[model samples]
Target chain A: MDIKEFVAQSIGQWRSQRSAHHLAFGHFEAIRSEIAIEVVADHDPAVIELCKAHDIDPGSAVAPFRMRWEGQSDWDEEEEVKGTCILVPVPDPGQANRGKLLRDRGYAETMAAAGDYYLTADGTFVLTTAYDRAAAEEKIWFINPNVRCRVSLIKTSAGSGVVTASFSSEIRQEIRQEIRQAS
Target chain B: MDIKEFVAQSIGQWRSQRSAHHLAFGHFEAIRSEIAIEVVADHDPAVIELCKAHDIDPGSAVAPFRMRWEGQSDWDEEEEVKGTCILVPVPDPGQANRGKLLRDRGYAETMAAAGDYYLTADGTFVLTTAYDRAAAEEKIWFINPNVRCRVSLIKTSAGSGVVTASFSSEIRQEIRQEIRQAS
Candidate 1:
């Protein structure tokens, strides 16, 4: 699938179980989270603002979407982790499988970041983002329509060392209201 | 499961489909291979040689095994790709989930190499090896007893840039002789 189709297939509620290794601290953490991905209209205010922030034409964006997640980690049970981010994909005019991705919230850090994304021959999405304090590389692939897997790495700012590595398996959970409405 | 149990459960035959992205070359390759993993006794010559090469006592090694693979890649259909490697795991006395792995053939380069290995809390095997020209990081986890997935990255010698990234899905193919013997 291409970028647009990948984003389309990813719209839904998902339950993700993640296992992470913090190499720098020699610690391992497990987390369970609920994630929601939804498409945002091209003319949405958020989309326009994100485009402005990145100095891109909102009209050039394709398959813009937002992702939100809430979860608990074993490292800190009392603390609930959550965030929301808008993602805007701007495909390369010359290359069909590669493009730049604008993110309002970065993966390795909580900042606006732009990353390079490309799809492998098997349709796995590979993304690499560089932040102020660190760089991150992530790969996401679907095992089936309802199941997917993600692996991510958080590296040092210079990208010489990996501080954290994680693997997550996400299973789609159909929204009850949507099912009811469809029925 | 601990390292020993993981190795035990991995015995048998497997069919693997791999997709790799060579970043430096900007090329994608697909490979189909049949893998066979078999247990090697502590006294086996190959196991002993591998342990000796790493300056480790053969008696200290746990669950030494041999892996053999034969495959063809899309990039070169006529050039058959195959290799055999013997792996010896020397577990840390203090940590049950971490150890040093000695391999007769390295992943990124075909040279004897030693790597650090650890199992995440969820039983994902992670390994990092430093080679002469590149470094490699690999993670392997089982979705179930019959299926497993592996992701690997080959990076620059200093590990700043990823030169190649690959993901492989393997399905267990029980040998007919093994089934007959069990029955």
Candidate 2:
């Protein structure tokens, strides 16, 4: 599918179960989360504000997304971690599946991030982001229209030019309605 | 280039510089390393041993590799970190650029890893591995015959199914001779 259609299809509720691996510490964890993705109109106030914050032209953005995640991890049993982000995809003229992914909050909440997104010929969605001191790349693909899978790679470093830790995750996703109604 | 050509071309000493980004911890570090890749003959003792260890017939392995890495990082200043591993690629019958990657020492040395390797239509080399508690996927491609780049994603999980950390890295490589002579 083309980039536009792919983005449009992603507007829905998804429940995901992910298995994460911490390479440096030799540990693993199971995580479950629910994600809600909604499309924001180009002229919406939030989109406008995001564009202004990132110095992006509102007209150039093909799609703006508001994503919310609510989940609990094994490490923190009592609290459900929650986060929300606005993602804006700006135009990339010459490349297929290549564009800017602008986010309201990056690796750290205090910073904004502008990253790259690409859709491969085989329908794999790749997103890469670089922060002041951190960077990440995530790849997502659909096993079917209702089932999605993701792989993420994250790294952190100390000031003295050494990698302090590395982590990776494998996530499986299904439509929330299908999962709920089946049960 | 075809898979055979690609593998043959990779025989050389390489100097690499990598920037690792940690997502959850919000840090970045620079790492420098040198690698030497040599082809292991089909009848080599190491290849034979690896095939025996992995329970594969020696004749099925397309190529066996001996790779050594020597590097230093910020976390440890005085001592150099070093490792060596044997990578054996078994025949892939049905898919193009797809095969099994059998490694003597994976991620942390505690587990042996059997992974999949695929060469994309665009010539990107992709490797994916799953251990009992950790998983990783890495992509490598050559900008030209002499310049190569790689991106890696590693994840570790606990038995209870929670992901504690994620790590990602971007590495650039050049022929060791050129790098050394220029320096």
Candidate 3:
């Protein structure tokens, strides 16, 4: 399944299983414009209580890991991620027994209300791109929080699965340094 | 008309109207993917002469102005784009002209061939928004890259009218910069 599908099911299961609370974007529009959320004292209580409620360890639940690209890495093995890089903790999607915990705590109702919420491999929030340009032979897609991808899609047979994942052979250069770092 | 209608007509009259260069991207598949061009070098003489040959005055041509958002801005004006803002530039229909110019000069048939071919805004670039949360809604509906935008299409009791010509919104934020710059 594509990203949106993973959110509605997989993301929720992980959140509750880890006994963590998060502010869900749900199906909030993240296409062209933006809206911001701040993490402040107000957010601490919910997070702390959730941490305490769950017997699972919280320290190792999330951390930043750099993705190594193919070929010689531009970075030294311990280089501090050249340029700017963003690191945020993400609850693992592979959480154990997350579903039952949600049900027992009556969080199922809340989870159901939140259309769906999944994170990418690097904890990036995502949404599909929209809009097209015939003159440019281009299709545009969207990911949340300061990211938009304008790439080309190839029509190749991927066995028999009806999936549409695009690649940017002509990607003209540089996404966010943070994302580039993470990617 | 809206972006689609504007694009079709621009393609029809691009060369006739002296637009020496153009670029565009259409919905390539079921999944919306975008392929766009970026100028690796803006001062290439052969390419610039071709631009001039098409009556595409590099000075008045919509290139620099259109790509303003995609490149770095020096915070000349200190207005902040609140929240998790993401800027996605719509592929203007004018990309066709850029390709045609290259073809006329036999510089390159497709951007892939030239390696140096870049996207210069032929007309207006539109920015659409999908909110992740809520805030003031200010959207710029500019379109038609190869030529100038008369007025964006607006439906009213008096049939329809073009949107007023407004330059691209001037606010630039550091965190929400374009992944690619036209330079």
Task: Give Cα-based local distance difference scores for all models.
Answer: 0.78, 0.63, 0.22
By summed lDDT, which 10 consecutive residues of candidate 1 chain B come out lowest? B174-183
Local lDDT at B141 for model 1? 73
lDDT of 2 by residue, B41-151 (tens): 889888888889888998888768888889875555687868888888885876547888888888534567888888877677878777775667676765446555565
Q: Which portions of model 3 show Cα errors greater than 4 Å?
A: A1-33, A40-43, A52-54, A58-183, B1-183
Give the Cα RMSD of candidate 3: 21.7
Which sequence of candidate numbers ranks them by DockQ, best first? 2, 1, 3
Residue-wise lDDT of candidate 3 within B27-134, one digit each (tens)?
111111111223323454544554565555543223211111122112322442221111111222455322221212111111111111222232232322111221
Off by over 4 Å in 1: A1-183, B174-183
The local lDDT score (0 to 100) that residue A31 gets in candidate 3 is 12
lDDT string for model 2 (A21-117, tens) is 4433323444567777889888988778877887878888877888888887666778886888888888587665788888887643357788888
What is the C-alpha lDDT profile of model 3 across A1-183, one tens digit per residue? 333232222211000000010101101111111112122231344433444455534343232211121211112333332121112233445642111111111111212111122333323233221122111112222222222232222111222111122221111123222323442
Which residue pairs in model 1 clash with each other?
A: none
Evaluated at residue A176, the lDDT of candidate 1 is 25
What's the DockQ of model 1? 0.03
